[model samples]
Target: MLALPAESVSEADVIAGILALMRERTGYDFSSYRAQTIRRRIRNRMISVGIHTLTDYLVHLKSVETEALELLDRLTVKVSHFYRNAHTFDMLREEVLPGLYRRFGGPLRIWSVGCARGEEPYTLALLLEAAGIPGTVLATDIDEAALRAARRGIYLRDALRELPESLIGTGLEPVPGDERHVRVRPALRRRVHFQVHDVTGTALPLGTTDFHMISYRNVLIYLQREVQERTLLQMRAVLRDGGCLCLGEAEWPPPSVACSLSPLPQRSRLFEAIAAEPIA
Candidate 1:
C-alpha cells in the first residue's frame, strides 16, 4: 500500500488558525466561510506580519493581541453604507412597502440581519418614516464593535454624500455643532433597535415579531450552504405570510428551496414569500 504524502500546510492554514482563535475568543464563527477568500485575506495578513510558515504565524498571533483583532476585523468584511444600493431602496419605496402597508396597516416590523454599523436599518427607519409608515426595526450583527458604532447612530458626513438628495432632504438632518457626524432624527432613531447577535447561533434577543420585511443582503455569501439553509429557514419562520425578503443585487437563494420571486424594476432583487396552504 502506498503511503499518503504528508499534509503540507500553507498560508490558508495560518488564516484558518487565526479565524479559529477569533471564534474561541469572541464567539463569532467564520469557519464556514468560502476558503479561497479566507485564504486571500490570511495571505494578506501574512505579508503584513512578514511571516512565512503557518506554524510560526500561529505562534505570533497568540503573542500579539491588537494585531490579531485587526486581522479579525479585516477578515469579517464589514463594508456597508446608507442605502448602499439605490435601486433596491427605490423598489422598497415604490412597490414592496406600499403593498405591505396595504396588507398590514400600522406598526410594521422589520429585521436587518448582519446590519453592519446600522446604516441599512437606519435607512429603513428613514424610509418608513418618510412614507408615513409606523414601524420598528430590529438590527442585529455578530460584531459587538460594529453594533456599538451603529447604536451611536452617528456617521461621517462623507458616508451620506451619495444619499439621494430627496432622501437627505426629507429623512436626515445634519448634526448640529458636529460637521463630521450626522444624527438620525429622533423619531426615526427611536424606531430602530440595534443588538449584537451571532447569526449562526440561536435566534436574536427579540420576540417572534410579525416581520413584514427582512433585509439580509450581502451576508449569505460568506456562509456555507448548510448555514445559509438554516438561516433562511429561521428567517422564513419569522416572516409573515406574503411578506418580502430582499437580497443584495449580487446574492441569490439556493436553487433547492422554493419561494415566490417578484422581480422589481431596475433589477432590484425583492422576493416575496409564498403563502402556505391552510390545513383542512
Candidate 2:
C-alpha cells in the first residue's frame, strides 16, 4: 500500500477506497455513517497511522489485521459514563422501575444495545439493585475494545462525578489498595453481561421479544436516518410489549417508530413499546 501515489488521489476517492477496502477485506461497512464524519475519521486515522492518504491506508489494512481492527475500534470508541443522563436515570429509579416491578415482577431482563464501555448497563444494574428490583442486564457493543473495557468492570474515580453521594457503595466498591479507582461490585457484575455484537448486522443477539428494557442511548444519532428507522423496527421486534426503550436526550424516533411506541408522560427520551409486531 505504501508504494502507490496516494498523494495524488482526491479526498473523495480516498474515502471511497477506504470504505471499499473495509467492506471487501473485513465485511465491516461504514457506508451508513454520515459522510462528513466518515471523511474526518478517515483523515484522523490516516494521521494516526502515519499515512498521508486513504489509498495507502487501505494497503496498510490489507497487510495488518491488528491495525485494521484498531482502526475499527477507533471509529467506534464511545466516551460514556455511569448514569450519563442524571434525570433519565432518576426517572428510571423512581417511576419506571416501580411500575415495571409491579407489572412484570423482579428478575427482569434488560438489553443495553450499542453499549460502550459498560456504563449504561452497570448503571441499570446499580439502579435496579438500589430499588430492590432484581434484574439482569445484557450489554452489547460493536467495538471489541469497548467490550473488553466493560468486562474489566473497573473505572476511574472521576466516573463518579455524576453520582449522588448517597448512592455510593451501593453498586461500586473501592479496589483494595487503589483510592483513585473503583470496581463495580462483583455481585453487580454477575447481573450485567457484556458481549460484542453489531446491531445492524444480519443476526440479532436476542431471538425473541423477551427484554423488558433496551437502553440504547446516543448511538442512533451516529447512523443515518433510514438506518435508524430500520434499527428501531428491529428493536421493536425483539422488545417485549410494554418494555421501555431509552435513547439519548437529543434523539427522537421517526414517526414510523413513534407509531408503535408511546412516550412516557414526563420523559422525552424514554418510550414504552406498544403493540409490537409479533416475533416469529
Candidate 3:
C-alpha cells in the first residue's frame, strides 16, 4: 500500500492528496468542488470506514480500489425529492414549458443535468404529459449508481410528498404489495432517458445548440466558482435561442455568463438564453 506522511501532513494536504489520487485512479475529478463540501464528505467517509485521521484515510484510500469509488459517491452525494421546490415546478408547468414548446415546435427536448435519482427528469416528463406535448427528456448524472436507480424509476412515498396531487395517480403507480413505495409509470418513464455524464468533462451530451430547456437546479452551489462559471457557459452554448434555463432559487448565472442569459420577468430563477447576442 502506498502511504502519505502521517506525522507531518495537515488535514488539508491529506485531503488534496486524496482528491488528486481519486482523479488519477477513478477518472472523476472532485478537485473543482468547494473545499468545505469536499472536507465534509471526506469526514463522513472517514467515519463510515472507522478511520479518524485524514492521513490514515489517505493511505487507506490508496490501498483500496473500491474505496476510491465509495469516496467518489460520498463526494457526489445525490439527495433530491420530486418537485423539490413546489413553486418551481408550478412555474414550469404553468408558464415556462408551454412557451418553449410553442416557440421550438414539435418534439421538445429537455435536459436535466445533475438529475440525481431522476426526480427532476421524471417530473419534467409528467409536465410534458400533462400539457399534452410531444417531448423527451435526457437525464444525466456523474454517478453511475444514481443513474441505475433512476432507470429503475421507483421512489418511496416521502420522496413524492411534494409531487402535485393531480400528478400522483397519473405519473406513478403503486408497487405490488409495497404501499410505501411507488414507481414512475412505465409510460412516463419511457419519455426519459438516463445517462452517466460528468459536467467537468469536455464533452456535452447530445451536442451544442440542442436543448430547448436545461434544468440545472441546485447542483452549482457545491462546485467551485470557476467550475460554476464554466458550467453556466456550457449551458449557454447548448441551449437553443430563447431556451429556458432553470436554476435553484438561490442560484444564478455567474457574471461571466450573465450577458448570454436574461432572467425572465417574475420568475425567480428562470433565465432565457440570448443566443444571438454577442456575449461581451
Model 1 stretches astray by more than 4 angstroms: 1-15, 50-53, 260-266, 276-280
Which sequence of candidate numbers ranks them by TM-score, best first? 3, 2, 1
Look at candidate 2 and give me any clashing residue pairs.
none
Cα deviation of 86 in candidate 1 (Å)?
0.4
lDDT of all predictions, in order shown?
0.77, 0.81, 0.87
Q: Which lDDT value does model 1 have at 2?
A: 18
TM-score of 2: 0.89
Query: Between the candidate structures 1 and 3, which one is better when assessed by TM-score?
Result: 3
**Per-residue error at 168 for model 3, in Å?**
1.2
Error of 1 at 263 (Å): 4.2
Q: 170-242 in candidate 3: lDDT tens per residue?
A: 7899999999899999878889998888887778875435889999988898999999999888888888878
Better by lDDT, candidate 3 or 1: 3
Pairs clashing within candidate 1: none
Tens-digit lDDT track for model 1 on 1-280?
1122257765556566778887776667778777766766666777788876566667787888776676677677788888888878877887788789899887889999989988899889888988988888999887778888887878887777657878875656788888887777788789998877778776655665669998999888887888887777788778887888888777777643334434454566777877643323
Listed per model in order, the count of residue pairs whose N, CA or C atoms clash below 3 Å is: 0, 0, 0
- Relative to the true structure, candidate 1 has a C-alpha RMSD (angstroms) of 4.5
TM-score of 1: 0.87
